[model samples]
Target: MESHILAISGGGFSVEEKAFIDEYLLKIPRKQEPLKIGFIATASNDAQGYIDEFYTAFKTEQPSHLTSKDFEALNIQEVVNALDIVYVGGGNTQYMLEIWQKTRFDIVLKNAYQNGVILAGISAGAMCWFETCYSENEEEYEEFKGLGILKGSLCPHYNDEQRRIAFDNWATTQKNNILYTLEDNENLHFKNEKVVAKIRT
Candidate 1:
């Protein structure tokens, strides 16, 4: 199996972006037909609002995610294996990581990537794939440890996030850091932890 991941800069979801995202998942080589994609809203604590938005943007019906099943009932690995793609929603990265760790999804997701399942997300979703990431936090700014599915740190919503009062000295203050920034409508494509600039859209 090959490893492929995409970390997207989050903005309001749209049809064009949805088309691009779906295209990415469909293009990935898979022996399976009628690929099954799952959405993770752990970042938003599986918020129903975000879940509804995701389905709306993807132009589909809602799917079960922690709401229909006990959190403990979830077999993260099994669920991941049954799917071709896992799309995560944006929210508090730290909180999301904690839940995933407690549920052992941290390990399951790594296995999914190794199994050639496409992992993609935006904002907190995008940032989770790296060693570090920027977040749309309230009150104060904080750093977070990513899944290390890909190389370097990630700063999503670059253009939108810069307007926040807290992201000062963003360009020059952070030195000796491997950080990648993406504005809305842009994407980063990775193969085996190495980024392919040519495929970026």
Candidate 2:
């Protein structure tokens, strides 16, 4: 069992990025077809629109089952460990971290990775995989603590953010930690806690 994590930068659930995502997920190591993917949408507080988008994006794949793992359920560990892949949705980074911590999902996620589960996400989901995240938590982007499964920090939607012009400034001024930036289509993939490749879009 080894770690496999995908930090997707954009088109998390939108139809527009389906082609890339399909190919991406398809290429990842899987036990079998109709991969079991769990969507952790706690950041969005189990918002229906986000859930709908997640299913719509992966509809053609006909996954074994798509579920919202963060909506709070029984046998949480068993449910998470059983999945082939876990996809996290983006929204309110600050609140998402709070809930995940309170519920011990952070620990569960780390264990899942160790057990060879494929973990993936977008925006806040992407940023959370690192030691730190450069978040736009309150209008302007600022650095925040993260899960640290991967090293350093990450910034999502690099090209689309209004304050992106100051990215270099922000990174240079950070008191500590290196910041990894991501464009809408860029994705980071890791194996056993090490980067195998960065699929640049």
Candidate 3:
């Protein structure tokens, strides 16, 4: 039985988002088993801290983290066999991708998702999951390839960036693009590969 995926920008879990998850579960065709979570936080030094924060925020619990350099050493088949959600945390995108590719973490993540494990992320976690990302260097713009989880490219911290004008211009030229400059606790939730709603609180 496959599950739905929800990706959010970091700050904290939105109350509305939690309610949305509950509603989402009611609509998933199959009756869900006990929800198991695989927390992926290659970006944060205190990855467990972030995970704990989420658990406390949402009042949900699960076991183990599908994280680390030796993540692939663990049998993916067995780990994902019982997982219903895989929450990836934000970090340096380039570094995360490097580690992901090096340890075949990306492959494991895709497998989990394909097997009905919901996928979610924040910041770099969110940016990398898209097909492409608008990378901000010292000056000028560069398009970087991403995980291809979602079709279009993503630009995080959009409105907040000093180069807002330039970034907006670049995004305008691209056919499939979306920019986000969320405050401390703003997020967009997508369903069926399209942004179904946004929560600002």
Pairwise TM-score winner, candidates 2 and 3: 2
Listed in order, each prediction's TM-score against the native is: 0.80, 0.86, 0.73
Worst 10 residues of 1 by lDDT: 61-70
Residues 7-59, model 3: lDDT tens digits = 55545342334544333432443444446656677867436667666566445
| Tens digits of lDDT, candidate 1, 117-145 | 88878778888988765554575567667
Total backbone collisions, model 2? 0
Q: Rank by lDDT, highest first.
A: 2, 1, 3
Cα RMSDs of all predictions? 3.3, 2.6, 4.2
Q: How far is 99's C-alpha from truth in model 3 (Å)? A: 1.0
Model 2, 1-201: lDDT tens digits are 566888888874554765576468666865467777777778787887877777777776544333345435667777778888888878878778877887788888888787878888888888888887666766766667789898887788888647467666678776667677888878888887777878875
TM-score of 2: 0.86
Best-performing candidate as measured by TM-score: 2
> For residue 68, what is the lDDT in candidate 3?
70
